[model samples]
Target: MHIVVCMKQVPDSAQIRVHPVTNTIMRQGVPTIINPYDLFALEEAMRLRDRFGGEVTVLTMGPPMAEDSLRKALTFGADRAVLLTDRFFAGSDTLATSYALAGALAKIGEEFGKPSIVFTGKQTIDGDTAQVGPGIAKRLRLNQLTYVARIAELDLAAEEITVERRAEGGVQVLSTRLPVLVTMLEGTNEMRRGTLEDAFRAARTQVVTWSAADAGITDLTKCGLRGSPTIVKKVFAPSARAEKAHQIPTADLSFEALAEAVMGEIFARQPAIEGDLMRFSSGQ
Candidate 1:
């Protein structure tokens, strides 16, 4: 069995800043980390590899710095890593990203065998949109399992898998086939530390880097910003509302008198509310 885990390098939210001129994220000098949620997905994939004795591949698409995340994934025992970076892939929305990633996965299948499974985080903190995984699945025609909490069973010989999935207000037990994509829930498992051997291997390892063309993509128009259906026409912070809550003054006589005075002022301001209160008391 082989598993592919999609990871992303993201700007640490604590250090995120917007560029004044272009109205874009100022990533320069901003600390970058693996998408927090993807760490769990990577860890889970590693755990599965440890159990079933298979290979785990870490895949990512971003700037050159994204190679760092792939190396870190190798430290966690992933057997291979691939980086998809190109100028043409810039400004890609979810749809375009999914297309690029799917193309890369296809290349991987031709080069190294088809991965039995693919894992992704539930959502990216920067985008906060959980559409890429499903989009990739649709393109690859792979079974998709989102918000998976656990891998209940796996029949490698039969190419079947069963998992526990979390849905709105409930848990769903789903069964699917191999070549599936699973979006892992956060905290499903903990990340592991790399041993000395793992660290050395990661440091010297060269991840397979490919441009959009090398990934078997020919149509330049159906990539990056051009392929994205949704566009952010503008980005601006929300303005704060002006005004403060009314302050209730205290009475000199006693605490109860002050409380009564506050309530009385509010009731006086809205007589209809007092009428509704009376009706509620009468059980009508």
Candidate 2:
């Protein structure tokens, strides 16, 4: 079984700054890290590889400096790393990004046998759109499973997979075939720390770097900003709110008392909510 994990390098959200005049993100001097959500995907892929006795290849599309994140993934036991960077891929929105990524994935399959499963994060911190994963799946004509909480089973011989997907109100159990794309939810598994030997191997490994042409991406018009139709009219931070939290005091710290005190505060703020809760509890 070959598992492909899609990852991204993004500016640390904690230290990200918005330009005062331009109202755009100020990336200069900002440190970069693997998209936090993608870590869960990587960890899940590694776990699957460990159990199935296969390889996990991590792929990312970003600038040349983004190679740092790919190397970091190797330290976490990914069998290989590929970086897709190109001038034509600059300023790509989710649409163009997915297109380029899908193309690169095709090239990867040509070099390393076609992957049985592809894993991606629930969302990226920078984009927060959560569209790229589905977009890639759509372009590649692969079955897509999003917000997957658990992978129940995998039948390599039968080429089938079962997973529990988190939906709006409850979980949805789904069974699908191989060559599927999964967007893994966060906190499903913990990322492993690399051993000294693994770190050394990662330091020496040369990441496979490819440009748009190298990845067999034709039609330059469909890449970068040229292919993206979405327009960003403005990018600004929300105004700071002045509201503060209200504390509810409880005597003796008893569970019942604390619960009642918290409910009392909620009722005090929204009297209608209390009546609604009572009616619902009484099945009205």
The best candidate in terms of TM-score: 1
Question: For candidate 1, lDDT tens digit of each residue in 191-229?
Answer: 988888898888888899999999998787878999889
List model 2 lDDT by residue over 1-284, tens digit each: 88999999999999988888787888999999999999999999988888998889999999999999999999988989999999999999999999999999999999997999999999999889999999999999889999999999999999999999999999999999988999999989899998888899898888999999899999888899999998777767788778867766656789988998888888998999988998999995
| Per-model TM-score versus the true fold | 0.86, 0.85
Clashing pairs in 2: none
Clashes of each: 0, 0
* Candidate 2, residue 270: how far the Cα is off, in Å: 7.8
Give candidate 1's error at residue 182 in angstroms.
Answer: 0.4
Give candidate 2's TM-score. Answer: 0.85
Best by lDDT: 2
> Which regions of candidate 2 are displaced past 4 Å?
239-284
C-alpha lDDT of residue 143 in model 1: 96
